[model samples]
Target: MANIVSYLAREQRTFEEEPFNMVDGLVMATLAYLRYERYDRLPARPSEPFRLHDVLALASWRDLLAGSWMRDAADSRSFLRALMASRRYRDAFVSFYVSESSDAVEKQFSAITLTVGDGCVYLAFRGTDGSLAGWKEDFNLCFMDVTPSQQAAVAYVSGVASALPGRIVLTGHSKGGNLAQYAALCVASDVYGRITRVCNYDGPSFLGDPSPRVGDPTYRAMLFKAVPESSLFGMILEDGSDYHVVQSSAMLIFQHEPFSWLVSDGDFLYRDGLTRTALWADGTLDGWLKTRTPEQRAQFIDTIYDFVAASGVKTAADLHRNFGSIVMSVASSTAKLDPETRAFILDTFKALVGVVGRETAKSIDPRTRIRLPRRRESYDGSRPADFARSLRPAADGSQLAEAGKPSHAEPDGLQLAGAGGPCPAKADGVHPAKADDLRLGECGASLPVPCPSAPSPEASPAACGGVLDKD
Candidate 1:
């Protein structure tokens, strides 16, 4: 039942008393998601560092500015209120807030520096916001090593490191976590030497070799990577840094939201490693990425971006306003893609599903049965059903939440948790050639599978049921 809000509210100990730990790192990283730039009282670039208490005194949850654009805006506003009222963080200070969203370069970057108790400094980079541009940057990470955001992060860390004197920690959730690590290594030696830790909370790793910016051999010691047991975005591409899994209360992709992570007396509930499904997913994804050349990645990614752009929606707010129009725009756009690009999308999806299906069969107990929800064919052939409405299993009971609107704090897709009776044998004249033809998602029962947008089977677990079902 405990989360960061409750933990901080009850916490009387200062940073000096308790010292910084995984929990503190997670907390700071989560705070980075707040639209700090929109809060005018917080110091911006070239401005001297401002005390956290002073800023909180002037700012209210009403002016936090997450309400219009951020996913789960209400929860985020409440979280900020908790932080502002916390006794533990009164000594913390903030400065050098920067945020940029540019469609021309397909980049969305934001970072803030928090100097706490004159001892520890956190350079917190934000992950994807509601912007489609933000999501595109995440896609860019799949092919490129150093994103524009990463470069900005490096500069941000270097610019503020000397001015803010402390034992520095580069920290963030999602792509922000990726940025933190990237900034740590890429900064000058003086700045790198001051960094005591780099906390990456469920961030993706580089697809290509990041050149000329490697830190000293000590970076491995500085790393503290934690991902949920059923991580998807965190497992993208290939990662060499060791990471441990943490238990999450929520299922599947929603686990990427740090708020869903389960906490104990003073720390996160730890697991040995990723779940069987996650391991299979990461391996499958790495294999899939390794097969494609960088050129192919760029070409295919551009095609996908085109579809998103065609929707004419910019941010999560826009998504909420015009869901129907956006869907229509995306569907029409998909049909206009060159034949080769269309083939690539379909061929790639089939191959990935085949691999996941084979893995599921091998990994699970064939005797067990999993009842999956039926698939309706409303998706544009290019769009997957995984991004649609989901009936989430909440703590109290079932609740409805929209999928693929952007995550609460990271570069993760919204989860589509559809649990129901059984699949219809016929395709409803919508999707003629389905993955069910390949026997893609079942153990023994012949359920007609409706395809979900799974990079691996793990991405959309509820829709593609069988081996990954918890019950």
Candidate 2:
């Protein structure tokens, strides 16, 4: 009966056409969470196969895309209305990975809410896939690889540019920003002229020293980058896009959801406290394993792969939940670990959680102690770590950044970091407070600023060659 219910929910929600939106995001998030929570309670052996959550999540996500979320003029009030309208956002996101193709195996993913504002659509696929399969996967609201995803994104926006008969705007979460930039690059001469700007929220680092040009030059000309003060994921990318660094209350750095910026009725204003801890445990775990004898790192990765392979869960959500449980056991020191391996296991687990907790904090409600909005006077865009580092902690544990730092004017506004790669765009211009900016951190905030703008790749500073900085 439970299986039937799950099947029906997934089937009823499948996306077969266009017009996706936040309703899809809600469904995907729901399925991902549900499948993650229950993967372990099912059969543990392949022969006795446990139900897969990936398929279900994918189905729900696709269904959301079939709606009209991607149309233009979409706003936060409408987005939230859509989210609240659904009962299962997490599940839909989790189940988005049930691909039957061999080609899409290696790619990062996201839901793209185009400027058209139909709502939203999950754009998932690997960058490595060739053009044929790539073209088939509805570049509009489907998964894709890095290269192909960029291509499709460009086409979508170029179409918008052509159709609008004027300038077009593009933005996305995570890899979506990368795609947006790629689209800007790919836009045709006439179409490119119509694109106004691009915004990327903490997307991954762009690959290549002589960065590969994927979209139109005009498109690249109008790109911007935004991230949380203590960003983890987006910081890995380069410093080319227009940048903005958001202040957040959620601890564990990455949790800075731009949407959380506090807003009052019409004005997006905020007042909250934010803090950062090294997540020392997170810092050393994986890298330590990698640093171990090369053979040890290889062995560690293999061991984890084997463990998951043996766990019977077959979907993305299932894998996440199962791996999470396994990690939790490692963190709690509750698993029956070997005498020689226990210390390593716990250390790795702690590090993993701290890192994920920081990133996940922006959207997921992992229990947190503090939350703050960016002070209008404090809107000088310094990195959060820099912000925290500048100030001493009060006895009450509040951070005191640059005393009498009477808020300087927000620089050309935007973007962070150390520990990872070179922290991009330190202080770019930040506009008036945004309503969404007050509630969500950078990753989710929708500031009412000019569309994104970017520096030329040829002009972008080279990756400090071979030295990936830490967060």
Candidate 3:
């Protein structure tokens, strides 16, 4: 079925001609997921706004989008190539960009600005990447009141809006969409009023009821949200706000992908409401969440994160790759946790298992589940391994990165060192914190301040990166 990529390839209308619609927003959101941090040809904080044509002029779509999306890498790259070439966005200015990722802290946030010369600028916030996918986001959000990413979103918009005098529009896919609305609600009144619209495509909602904080008529009038008929990500902890339903080409959990959302005539194929299975899944999630207090949920996520960190598995794919080892590692670590904490974590998974039993579960990626020997490494010469080798953990478990290098890892196997890439020798004395700063320079934080720090090493620099994929 036709999707956003198809729309980009087919649509020639400019913002002046047809106006910016949800389809355009989705394309921008997907482009926002592109990891510009990897290319040295482009500065992280460009002094002048970078035009879409400039990006297309530098690299082929494949190099620009290598290792961007965890799920729809090919489709996303295609969408990007078409976007950079399309008359609609070729002249658009993309600036004030920042992207950060830290396994040390379990959050990934990034945003970019798109100026289409239409008196409006789009603040495209990134959603989750491969590392922080559907399940990780669901678990981590249980305890966060306002994540560093959300705060950064507020600050990011505030900073950009203060600098640029155009009408503001906030949009994102997945968690990014959620941030667009959240930032709209929380940003200062003047900036909030400047925001003409906020588009949320399949992004989850906040931890608590946000209605009390939502006081602006501007916000209410500008909000636009859509979810797939069988969404799992969008419905999680939904705020009971109205949203349109769109038919999807994917099934059940995977319907969270905007690439799968059916598009026709520049709009989604509308549905009346979520599918019955989606309602059940949403109810199941709500029930499980209610069963645990915020504190319990927080503790449970912490416990799991602590376990994974201790296990020395860099990504979730690491756990699945050597199931026996992970099982043993988890067993050993489970004994360290207090009985209450262990029980809580177990109960949460127990509920998830129950939900899965009602419907068959599919693995995220089959290749990630298996280990490839160094000799067996394979790729089209561009993918996760190149990025992974750049950010591979140092002797002390800190990620050392070079500026403008794709020094990041996908929790899925693509980031595995075996993906056929040689790590460049590090300049002497690359501290994790310092390396983080360099990487941050390659991928700025986009905010005036660091994203909220998770509890950890006293010196942990606030981490941020160009996070890809919300689901």
Candidate 4:
């Protein structure tokens, strides 16, 4: 099925002709006007709302696209180019009240208001950007009751609703969706009464119980949550309001991309239910999270944020590009954690692994029981030939291959991969033995043999020993 861009290009009918649908929700959510570095450059709100043509007339679309942190400039450009040219959205949708803020100590929030047709107004909240602080706030939601972004959303919604006279339709993608729901709930009864629908497109769930106002029949009836078949972010914490599963062309975590969502005839192609992969992940995450106390969860969240911050990258894209360095930073931070906190982190990781292992085991055939082989003492790390001799066939009908050998080759001896001589240096310039020590420490595994402080030149090739030998 065609995606949103294709739908916008092909569909000619306006809101006046076809009426508002999920397709319109997707279009509003895709707006990157909040990412514009200079909001002052744009036309004023309400009194001088900018039409799609007017915004494009400013010749600042390229600058605005470049300023976006969450989406690629090309994608943003393509979407806007399609939007401005479309008969469906170009004339009907006009933007106003754009706001954005990034306060690491407080909150990261951005939103915009759009006038759709004559009587309806669409409040579009931007989702998490590339800011590390924004992501941290999202993780904080796992423990905290109300985030700063949610509070800002409430204030923005209330202020905008009072000033504008129309049937309000709240909409957002990702964290924006979460804000939309929270703001809708926090508004006064009269303000809430003006809201016709609250469309949450793959938004996450609140940590604790929702406000009593959300439980009111009138408010609950206005909620509309839609998620992709293999949703990850949308399935976090809880599945609030009965969610509609939409088909997506992307797989796994990439399904979170709204562009991947399948659209047909200006509406999302509905799926019967969430995909099995989504359910499995949701269940596994929920199960692992249940094993941790509230304090533990908070600590875990803090530790993650601390590590990310320690990397000195402000955006997720930068962090991902420098992942190797970030990992090293994380390892250094892990080493510095207090004994108790370190143990808690390790134990929490082990529990998560156990959950995944159990689920994996359940999916395997009953007749083929799986077990890890016991460590061997005779395996000498120094001798490549002797290490290969200790190899055995696994239950999966595969034999361990010698290091640096072809996958089909039989194990000949214990030798570090890419290590040509007795004492091979790892890619990081550290000795293989020392590198193994760091790996073992990171995994909380006891070193079977003490690692040498330095590589010994005089040591015999047959006398070498380490985790590689035992493996």
Q: What is the lDDT of residue 104 in candidate 4?
A: 54
* Cα lDDT, all candidates: 0.64, 0.35, 0.65, 0.65
Report how far residue 427 has shifted in candidate 4, in Å.
41
Candidate 4, 124-230: lDDT as tens digits: 88888777778888887766767878877877777666555656778889999998888877766676666777778888977554466656776666677889998
Candidate 1, residues 399-466: lDDT per residue as tens digits?
33334332231112222345333222211111111111111111111112222211211112111111
Question: Root-mean-square deviation of each candidate, in angstroms?
Answer: 17.0, 19.0, 20.0, 20.0
Off by over 4 Å in 2: 1-79, 82-104, 107-148, 158-165, 186-190, 209-221, 238-242, 253-258, 263-310, 314-316, 324-471
Point to the candidate with the largest TM-score: 4
Candidate 4, pairs of clashing residues: 384-413, 385-413, 387-413, 387-414, 388-412, 388-413, 388-414
lDDT of 2 by residue, 1-471 (tens): 111122223333322222222222222222221212223343332112222333332333323322122221123234334443333332232112221222243222332221112222222222212222322322211111234345445544543333223234455555555555555554555644444445565454443221233343533445555555555555442433345554444455424333332222222222231123322222323233233443444444444544544455343445455777756543444355585676665565576565454333332212212223345434467665555544544344423234434222223221111122221222112111211111111111111222232221211111101111111
TM-score of 1: 0.72
Q: Which sequence of candidate numbers ranks them by TM-score, best first?
A: 4, 1, 3, 2
For residues 1-471, write the lDDT of model 3, one tens digit per residue: 899888888888876676777777787787787776655567544435777677766755556655445334447666666877788776787777787665555557788888775666688998776563333554666666666677677878887866666567789998899888878777766766566678899988776544344544545556778899988778776756779999988888778877888899888899987775776667556656665666777777777766666777655556667768867887788877788877777788887776554332221221222223343333446666664554454343334443233344334322334456432222221111100110011111333532222222211001111111111
Q: Residue 337 deviation, candidate 2, in Å? A: 18
Better of 1 and 3 by TM-score: 1
Residue 48 miss distance in model 1 (angstroms): 1.7
In candidate 4, how many Å is residue 29 off? Answer: 0.9
